[model samples]
Target: MDQTQSSSKALTLARHVLRVEADAVAALADRLDGAFDEAVALILARRGRVIVSGIGKSGHIGRKIASTLASTGTPAYFVHPAEAIHGDLGMIQRDDALIALSNSGESAELLTIVPIIKRQGAKLIAMTGNAASSLAREADVHLDAGVTQEACPLNLAPTASTTAALALGDALAVALLDARGFSANDFARSHPGGTLGRRLLTHVRDVMRSGDDVPSVTPEASVAEAILEISRGGIGMTVVVSAERRVVGVFTDGDLRRAFAQDIDLRRARLADVMTPRPRTLAPDRLAVEAVEMMEHFKINQLPVVDDAGTLVGALNMHDLFQAKVI
Candidate 1:
């Protein structure tokens, strides 16, 4: 074929493959039945961890499922079937539950250790295309992961079948996660380096400037005094306060520019006259991400942190959220 024709054919084939794989994954939802429920129940009842095993492409999918299960409060690990035959079968315990994946339900490597797992009193859940296959028949629960066709043009590579298996694995993990009442905080604990961790685990108090670090000026002070405080605090804003240290208003660099443009004398202007009254604020215990959202919404760079009675306790700026990775 010519170069243009070859590229065109390849593009068409790629689209066709994606369509076939997508259909395979979609069909899994309709195939759900009593077996899926049984599998979930068995796993939930187990006091020990889940042992996932498979061979070849199924092994790759099994590893992902095990990882997902571990992260979502299910405590699972993948064991290569080939390795299990060599010596890794020692990892399986009597109280553990086993999930074995094989499209044909007849992989020799998996069969080698299945009997030992059963002999040890571990429950076996089989994910396979053939319900009548030996592994499915022997399993305590059989989850149907069948697909009608492969995405490969030759219909020989494991494409649609693997996709269906992977989707079913995700469904199982999510079902278990819901059953266990796993919260966002629990999920964040498993992914402390991720953005969700920063959002859920970081509070405003952890990042906000406290004590004398917060810029402040009395309402009776001059606008020039507030400007000096804002500069000294380096957060581009200063809180105007009452005698009892309750926040009355806030004066930012932006407010200074506007005041100057209006021809107001900074030296003579009182902070009360130049500051924004009752500016947007947040509680110290609130999430840093909430501060980010409020700042973005109100177009403010800094916010005074307050107590339940609206007493000024701290101060935070956009840089604080960014430094905490909440941005």
Candidate 2:
């Protein structure tokens, strides 16, 4: 009961728990076999969603697994086991697949519904620590999620078992993702409001300011006239175009400052003399994220957008992309 003795005991318990959980997850690699494939096959073949359910800690893990499957191009959702028996069994359909979690495989609430799910012609996939237990034996496919020992010293808590189940769930998700050739674009579509979705789906045309919003000047345009266009457009830069309206170069505020440093007469100088030649431009078809990358890499804030023939079509600044969430 002394302070030092209490602290020492707690530290020892913590170390033992960490070691046990780590071993639980590490053992999962060797446990991978055809059952994982059978589970994926059941899910990939389903016309309806994957219905995940469990109780307590297993329920928490089931919800996360359902979300991962849903966001990764597999349609899935979670249903509470107790709720399923109370008219929630209607949630199960002939085309859907069910994934149930139970470390003991004998949770009365879960066992109560396995027959009902099978009766409805829905396939049940069980993730359990005991293969011979009721839920596992009844499942169309049973995944072994056994742990060598619980992290609890008395060996009766769900700690290591839950870790094993979560890892196995992730393995199933990733395997299906690869098998289906689910790409980043597919993930982004399911997550359109998320940052990754914005980065992947935004095209230059979606964010680039067009028509009267663009700053443009003729190659014959005077430096003073180009400055007026840039100032009017408020992009801190102007696209210098030829008589045919094709972009030949770009002039910015820095170009004007350099002109001032050299004592060049703004009224007399032409834009070509002060413009940066071979200025970078993006096609409207390019991803807006690429535009952000170009701006960051070249250290420029404003860029001209051009057509396949290199004619000036539009202009954009960093602010435009930021507002569109492409940055």
Candidate 3:
């Protein structure tokens, strides 16, 4: 074929492959029935972790499925069928559940180990294209991950079938997540290094500038003193406090600008004269993400951290949240 024709055909083939896979996943949604519910219940009823096993492309999809389940609250791990027939079979316990992935449902390696897993009293949940295959018939719960055809032009590669199986696995995870009352905090606990974990688990105290690092000045201090404190703290603001260290107000760069706009003498103007009294504040126990929301909602960058008695404890700004990866 000519260069232009070849390029056009490649683009057309790519689009067609995407459509086929999308349709395969869409079909899985329609095919859902009591079997899907049975699969979820089977997994939920188990007291031990889930063991996922497959071969080839199914193995790749199985690993991802295991990861999704693990991160979403279900304890799961992937084991290769070949490895299972070796010494890895010891990993399967009576209390555990096995999720076996096989497009044809007749994978010799999987079939060989299915009876052994069953004999040991572990429940089998089979994900396969053939509902009546040996693996499905032997399973305690069968999940039909069938697709009409492969996305490959030759209809020989495992494209659409893998997509359908992955989507079904996601569906199972989400259903189990809801059934087990899995909350965002629970998910965050399992994924402490991710952004959602940082947002949920990180508190104001964790990111706020505490003790001497927090800039502050008494209400009696001049605007220039507050300005110097603001610059020194690098947070664009300084807290105005009483003799007891109780927060009374906050003087920010915006406050300084307003003072300049009003032609107030910075060298002589007291902080109390230009500071915002009872400014928006947050307790040190609140989430850092909440601080981001408060700052966005109030159109302010800096916040004074306070205690129950409104004592000035710390301070933080948008930069702090960003640094903590909580924004």
Indicate which candidate wins on TM-score: 3
Off by over 4 Å in 2: 1-15, 260-265
Expressed as tens digits, the lDDT of each residue in 189-216 for candidate 2 is 9999999999999999998888988888
TM-score to native of every candidate shown: 0.94, 0.91, 0.97
As a TM-score, model 1 comes out at: 0.94
Compared with the true structure, the alpha-carbon lDDT of candidate 2 equals 0.91
> What value does the lDDT take at residue 55 in candidate 1?
92
The ten-residue window of minimal lDDT in model 1 covers 265-274
TM-score for candidate 2, residues paired by index? 0.91
Candidate 3 versus truth, CA RMSD in Å, comes to 1.3
Model 3 / residue 279 / CA error / Å: 0.6
Shift in Å, residue 69, candidate 1: 1.1
As for lDDT, the candidate ahead, 1 or 2, is 1
Angstrom error of the Cα, residue 235, model 3: value is: 1.5
**Residue pairs in collision within model 1:** none
Q: Which regions of candidate 3 deviate over 4 angstroms?
A: none
Residue 44 C-alpha lDDT in model 1 = 95
- Residue range 142-168, candidate 1, lDDT tens digits: 999999999998999999999999999
